[model samples]
Target chain A: MARILIIDDEEQLRDLLKQMLSRDGHEVVTAFDGVDGMRVFNQFNPELVITDIIMPNKDGIEVITELLCRNPNVAIIAISGGRRAITAEFNLESAEMLGVKGILSKPFTRDQLREAVQHALGL
Target chain B: MAIKTKNIIDFKSEAGRILLTSMGALLLLMVSAVFLSSYLETQLGSFKEVVFLGLAMVIALGAQWFLLKTIQSPQVLSPEERVHTTNEKLRHILNSITRQVESALGIKNTAVGGIENPADMLAATLIQCVAIMSEQVQSLLSALQMGSNESLEEARQSFIPLIDKTAETITQYLHVSQNIDNQLRERINETQQLLLNLRRELATVPQNQQQDTSQLFACIRQMGDVLETHLLIDNVVKKQLEVVTHDTNDSAFTLITLMRDLSDQAGNLVRYITETISKINAMENGVDESVGYIVRIGHFIQDIPEKIQRDIQAIQSASGVIDSLSYLVDSIKEISFQTDILAVNAAIQAAHAGDAGLGFKIVADEVRKLAVNSNKAAEMIEAGLDTARHTIHEGLKFKFLEEVMQQMNEAAQMMDSVKKLQEGHEDMRQYYKTLFTVINQSNMKLAQDISEILGSIQYQDIVRQRIERMQAAMQRRNELLQEFAIQLDVTSGNNMDDFATALNAVLNGYLEEESYHGNSLNSSDDGDQPPKFELF
Candidate 1:
């Protein structure tokens, strides 16, 4: 089982991802935003990370960049909800450019999450 | 030429025209005084004529001073210059209006930058514009009051339409701005309602999501537990089936063995009963034979008395015959004795008649000899018959035959008792056969009941599968609830960074578009964006 981290400004989504990944038999950690996610990331040292774009303090792009800088081999899955300024597609593309391994839109299904996690963990 | 020049000068100066008119009147008075002086020298003295002349000069000097003083008052500007000066002042007021309008637009932009509601800023801008216009109107009115030239009055009269036009324009502007303000207020109110609804929904979302997530976790845990329990039950049931099957096999073996033993016993009993019945039948047949022989012997023994009785009767008849014969023989002997006597007499008589008497004596002697023979035979017969009759009487007694008959009756009674004993053995054998059949039927029923119980153990597996399916369905429902909460978060716009970024982008776009139009109306460039809308 892979150890996974979930980061999002939405607490409900964070908890949901954590629960879903945990149910797949992976160890899961959660954070509310980018800053908190970084703290939890260092503390947990998870093999995989799932993050949401357009968060407070720092967004998914910065979080991915920082995580990659710390551990070049760390895996990342980026999720985004479209806002007026940035579309979900744009955010996802940006995260991809920053070396995120996977991307998902808001309101994704359990199957989508599982597939994305599996890809991120190379499982 | 001088008159025309003087006329032109008089036309340019009201004071100069008044002075000429007063000089012409004074000259007419002097000519009239000269004529009046000759007439007055005749009527009155020279002193009266000199006083009239002095009064006329005083009148002319006073008229000149009054005309000069009236011309020197400061209301004497030219009509063209007054119109020029009034036009310049009107331009100043128009410039002030333009500046105020620009300032109002500037204030509007700056206020919009700080405020979320654009209507509030617009209203403030309109108020400032009105105030600036009011101050400029007051300044224009005071400047108009300081100079009262007749040309300025004409200029002021012409400027009335321009002020009315400015007032009309301001009124129209205020009216339009107020309408925009009202529209913006209504839109803002609607937006507030939408935001409030969103906030309320968002406020409840976390708690609801937490509860649903908890339930989901619990369901997953329950599903795990159910899986474990199902596996355990399966294992247990499998093991139980093996044990039960093994036990059933053993029991079946035992049952078959017992059935075999019972069958063997039943067969043995049936054979034994058949053999015993056959033996008893044989014994019964022997008893029947004995009974038949005893019956025959009884009948024969019963006939022996009758045969003895008949033999006695025959012997009696023989004795009777012998008695009769003895009697006859007695008679013969008597007769013979008598005949011998007679013959003796006859012979004596015959000596008397010797020859005739000789025949009679022969006859008598022959008769006497025959009679003697007859009496001797009769005596012999009577003695033989007496001996036979005594032997027959001794043999006629049935006492020994009666003892033989009693012995034959006892043998028949013994045969009947043996027949009863054989019947009792046959009845006992039938009773044992019926008991064996009942025991065999009961064993078969017990075996069937055990087999039925072993078949019913699969129901537990069915129950386990139903539980597992229910847990799986609940897990799916939990996942759906989680997705619903995520969607709620996305739509709520609770993340301020994203919300603000979206607002900025939208407002900038709106302002850029508006600025394109604003430059045409106000002759000013606007680059800064403002807040687009505000809600609760």
Candidate 2:
């Protein structure tokens, strides 16, 4: 099983993801935002990472770029719900350009989340 | 005749210009009157003539004063020119009133059109109306200044119409302004009603928010209760699994230890059994040889008595022959003794016959001596033969044969003991073979039971993982409800665009990974498709 890191500001979402992946016999870690995710990423060095595109303090695109810089082989899955003048789609596109391996929309089902995680990890 | 009168009159006017001739006539008349009066005074009295002259001079003086006064007065202007002057003043006043009225109308038009502020325009229109009324009053006062009475009446008539027209225009402007004011009031009332409805809606927002929060809290509490129950059950199951696994491992260890010990013992047992069987076989072979030798010894002992009986018969026969020889020798001696007596008498005689007797005696003596010696030999032979017969009559050889028979009975008894010992060794070999087979079957059954127990303990790990996932999913759902509440409050006063921006910013804060796809995310995506797996 792979070790996975879930980064999101929604505390509930982070907990849910951690539980789901851990159930599959993988080690799971959680972070509340992009900044916290980066800090934990260095400590955990998980095989896969799931992140959100629109964020405060640090956005998903920046996180993706920085994470890739640190470890090019790190797997990433980006999630978002579009908002405001900067759409979720637009932000997600930018994240894709920055090098994310997978993408999922907000409010995804457990199966979809697992698929995205598994695919990113090369499970 | 009238012509002749006219000609005489013309002759008279030609001789004197009328006023000059009249004055000259008056002077002439005065002079004549004076003369007449003098003559009358002379005829009547002097006072009458003097009074008439005085009256004539006073009348003349009054006529001259009237004529000079008429000529010296200011020149009279024409009635037409005075009417024109009064009409000009009225025109000027009406023109000013027209301009003021036009300005008021323009302000009212602006107010009605809603271009300018209505209140400000209304004030300006009122001022313009007041100015128009004041200028109309001034035009009425100027109309009284006409020169001729007729021209004064005409100016009054023209000025009244102009003043009335100015008043009418001012009234029309006032009516238009009033209509605009009514419309403005109605619009203000409608705006006030809209504000009141907005205030009532704002007041109900807090109640709605509180109700939603309460519902979310209840859901969270229920989740917490369920999670507690799950945890308790999980712990119990985990402990049971641990115990089972530990027991299985111990059993396997015990089975292995027992098998090893059994294997060593079985090896020892097999070696012992084989050695015992070999010794028993050797013993059985030895017993066969011993039993055969005992039978042969029994046969040899049975033959020993017969051989001893044969030896006893030969000794008895030898004794009988010795007795017969003694008897014959005794008989010969007796006959020889008689012959010797006779031969002695004869020998004396034969001594005489001795030569012949000598020859005969020699022969006889020799014969007699031989006869005596023969008698002596027969007696000795009979003595020896008697002793031999007596010794042979005793039981010395039979005693030897009886001792041989006694030894043969001891050998036969020893052979019977050897046969009993061989039968006992054969019984022990059969008992050892049955014991080895029973122990080998018991050891195999113990090894199989331990293997089954070890397999049951590995399934517990998967169950533990599933319980943990359920707890996490519930907790996350509770947190999402809280976020939705906060988002609702934030967007109540702002527009939809601003709310969208705020909500997106908050949600984006949690993102952790790299995004590799375009924003094709649909929140409402529903499908029956199963998940896909890949090897990265």
Candidate 3:
């Protein structure tokens, strides 16, 4: 399977995703937030990126702005929490605006993050 | 590039040769010209003054040719030389600027050592720097109008504004330097006030004799450009020496304070010692002394608490003593240095004292011996303090109040676990508050340390160390705004010629990726994952 990256602040969930992806024989890199997520994506040139919508410093919006400026070909899977937490949190519509191929919400089972990454990579 | 720059008149270099040649030949020609002209005017019976003047000019011209002519053809500057001359002037201007910058740098170095008195040194330094940097408007005219030979006219027209702009930078720095100096002076005065407060609380110091001496030295260190031009004054009046003196005094001040406080505490201990001696004497009296309250008092509940408090007080006093002694050693050294110089001055002044100076010499000798005794006693006190602290630390470190608190936390946690056995739930609340306070104190201390260390490092120095630190961070941030200002004035894009392009096609070159280390972000139009935390 092609390498995939997951960017999330939740350590527990990132760990779960890492385990599930490597089981599928794909190389997995995890980033804590949009800032490091973008940095890792640039350096590693990972075939696919799966990122969360909210982050501090350089947030998901900033990461998207910079990445598309360099290359438009890279595939992406976006996940969101919700506006119920804060109006700033990402929604499905903004993910569409950013050109994400797939979108998901939190409280999704292990099957969700894994299947999203697998589908985006065409594995 | 040519001897054209070397003119016969430029006595700045060959003054002696120019003076000798011009004075000798020119004077002879002029005198002969005047005599010939007057004689010819009388012969012509006024061929009018015009014709007589013409004949005088002719004779003067003939004599001047033989006398004033030189092998070098009286070198005047060539076109290239005009540029070099202008540049040379610019170099002098920059040199002056650099000297000021160096002085500022020197003062900055002094400030680097983390002393309470660096403010004074830095303020004086800024003043010197500003004087050097505060270029006049005339220098702007020179930097701008004085173009090199190749593009003299064009440079004169276009570069003047840049010179003006550079001048503006100097002016800005000057204003800032002055403001900073004022603020720094105020801060030093505040520090001096703090020092004065400590001294005042000390009560028994000889400040009347000593205060003026330090104040005078402080004034000398604060000398600016007027002092800097005299290279010796600027060079000798270093912040480093001031800082060393500062460090020595700081240690000594701390030493004196701690010693005084501990000595008072030692008096308290001496009272207990006297009591113990009285108890033994009472025992020897054998007057039914089985009910001696002193030994019994040590075992009582209230007495145990009092004894523990006393022990803690003793430890605090011991720590104070150690601190005081360290400072005492340092202060003594600095004062001795000051006194030595004063002594030398006095001795010189003593030579001129005549009979009246004998009494003053005696006073000086006494002062020196007093200084010696102060230094010796300070050393002994410091050694004693160090030994005492070592002994106290051995007994106290593990069993400090924190250990007692830890046991309380353990009992509280246990009690909370078995809350059903308790009559009230409010007991757990108190424990929680106590724990919170401790944690909050710990965090506050950490924050204080971070602020102190980072804030203490000068911002400009860090900026100079690596522009990339700020620039790189800014660059990353700039990408978000999507409008990073690329200075296009210099225009450093691929300057490929037509032939080069053709050659490149022949060689089949390919485009390369830009390296930005790990600073890469894939297009995540599909947002995923949770947000991360990063401090600003």
TM-score, per-candidate, Cα-based: 0.29, 0.25, 0.20
Give the C-alpha miss distance for residue B41 in model 2, angstroms.
99
- What overall lDDT goes with each candidate model? 0.51, 0.49, 0.45
Best by lDDT: 1
Considering TM-score, which of the candidate structures 1 and 3 is the better prediction for this target?
1
Candidate 3 - CAPRI tier? incorrect
Candidate 1 lDDT by residue in tens digits, B107-159: 33443222223323433443343334334334333433442233333433443
> Which portions of model 1 miss their true places by more than 4 Å?
A1-123, B1-219, B222-251, B352-359, B380-536
Which is the better candidate, 2 or 3, if ranked by TM-score?
2
Off by over 4 Å in 3: A1-123, B1-81, B95-255, B280-536
Please tell me which predicted candidate would have the highest TM-score against the true structure: 1
* Cα error of candidate 1 at position B335, Å: 2.5
Better of 1 and 2 by lDDT: 1
DockQ of each: 0.01, 0.01, 0.01
Rank order by TM-score, top first?
Answer: 1, 2, 3
TM-score of chain A of 1: 0.95
Instruction: Name the DockQ score for candidate 1.
Output: 0.01
Candidate 2 at B118: error in angstroms?
96
